[model samples]
Target: MLYHLAKNLIMILFYPLFRIKVTGKHHIPKEGPVIICTNHTSNLDPPVVGITASRTIYFMAKEELFEGKFFGRLLRKVHAFPVKRGLADRNALRSGLKFLKDGETLGLFPEGTRSKDGKPGQALPGVGFFALRSQAEVVPCVIISDYKLFRRTKVVYGKPMDVESFRKNKASAKEMSEGIMEEIRNLYEIHKN
Candidate 1:
């Protein structure tokens, strides 16, 4: 629909300009309720990750981006929803869970914000809460880039991590978040070297 059309247009513009390289695309579940956990480096991360994957992704964008009427309308059309940063926004969480419950893909940047140094930061507990609540698989995605115009950028998808183990152990939200961040960091290291 509109999402794919916009994605196709952006890919046509971004692919040649940035020389984006996506790896491990097969790791994405062909169909299922899954969480796409990725490291945020720049504003381009969402679109890049969205286009690289075979399935459509509903991403949680910061609330500030939705302040403008026209831009916010555009974002909504492309499957982007507003999320309040720095606090637990229940509405946003509910929306994300609803998507998963409906067997749709939900994209999240566990770090909560883009890294200034291009490294993965500590994950917020919301990701863990969502995974545990929905009992969905979490796929670790690593986006490596310097955000330079017309430069090379790489997006790596890691194997999906199941929430079963954490649930079996009765792990807390913080513990699950830490474990998820550890997995993402490991994926980053593996691809870095």
Candidate 2:
């Protein structure tokens, strides 16, 4: 499959180029529906997390990436789906939920967009909506680096947080988003060097 092939090749290629150091990989559950929430830094963040994680991840990419014919098809081949930005895109939300319901791994960037300064930012409420609605375990991951070529970059995966408690407590979407971001910040502070 294209996804697997790309991942294998990237695994080999990115190592020398980025010196991709990974930690806390065991924190990712081997099976079942799970969400991997990470900070958005560079355009390469998706693939970086994909190859490093033990499971195949279907990501929620921005809609414009799928505008071109060839590129759109290629993105699909790699298991990336388009999501309209700057508003609540229902179609995109359904796609994400369906993926989770089918017991697939879903990768998300809580910040919703890449950070120009490579620092974590506040998350949109979408991630929290998905977490609470699907009752999926949310893993807080942090990618530490300036993403400079041929430099060391660290991807740290933190333990999965059960969102079921939040769901039971009737937490708001914004609150859930804040909690997830806080988890990501904690992981970043601990591993950032």
Candidate 3:
């Protein structure tokens, strides 16, 4: 209820002003636990990805962004939970797992932070941990926008990548993360100019 209300309110407030286009939405899994992993580029990325998806996207935001009193509450109301940056925050991880156990979708940026340039950046291994622990399907997405305008924004929801088989590969944690990151880079390359 809160998520829908917040999304609707946000759409009413911003959609008219910005040029928005959302594609590849069909790739989103309709039911059960799923993680939508995306590339981070701008402050606009989370809401852009969240508002575009038909359902509420419970996304991870840096703990720093949740600092302001009013805005922070508003962001949380819309499902932007905070995780400490530069490392895995246990509380945030537990919260995420709990949400999955409850059958909710989580939107995460494996990169951990915004890309300095509006291009693909190295993704972190945190996603590997989520995949290992939650056993949720990872839905890949690349939100393409020219950084200046939201008008030409095209959030490409790529094919779902199953990390289950990869789990049994007996790779080290770092290897697993790099493997997931490799797939992410593939999608990034496949979609870019």
Top candidate (TM-score): 2
lDDT-based ranking, best first? 2, 1, 3
- Candidate 3: tens digits of C-alpha lDDT, residues 1-193: 8888767787775565566666678888788888888888888787777787756678887888789999899878888888888776899999899988888899988777788887767767787778778867778888767656345566778777867777778665556566666766777687675
The candidate 1 region of ten consecutive residues with least summed lDDT is 184-193
TM-score of 1: 0.96
Tell me the lDDT of candidate 3.
0.76
Which is the leading candidate under lDDT? Answer: 2
Ranked by TM-score, the better of candidates 2 and 3 is 2
Model 3: how far residue 11 lies from native, Å: 3.1
**RMSD of candidate 3 to the true fold?**
2.2
| Candidate 1 local lDDT, residue 56 | 94
Model 1 lDDT per residue over 1-193, tens place: 8999999999898898888888999999988798999998898899998899889999999999999999999999999999999889999999999999999999998889889998899888988888889957789989888868888888899899867889999998778887888888888898875
Output the worst ten-in-a-row residue range by lDDT, candidate 2: 129-138
lDDT by residue (tens digit), candidate 2, 1-193: 9999999999999988999999999999998899999999998899999999999999998899999999999999999999999989999999999999999999999999888877789989999999988957799999998878899999999999968778888999889998999999998888877
After superposing candidate 1 on the true structure, give the runs of residues whose Cα lies further than 4 Å from its correct spot: none
lDDT of 3 at 43: 82
lDDT of the candidates, in the order given: 0.89, 0.92, 0.76
1 versus 3: better lDDT goes to:
1
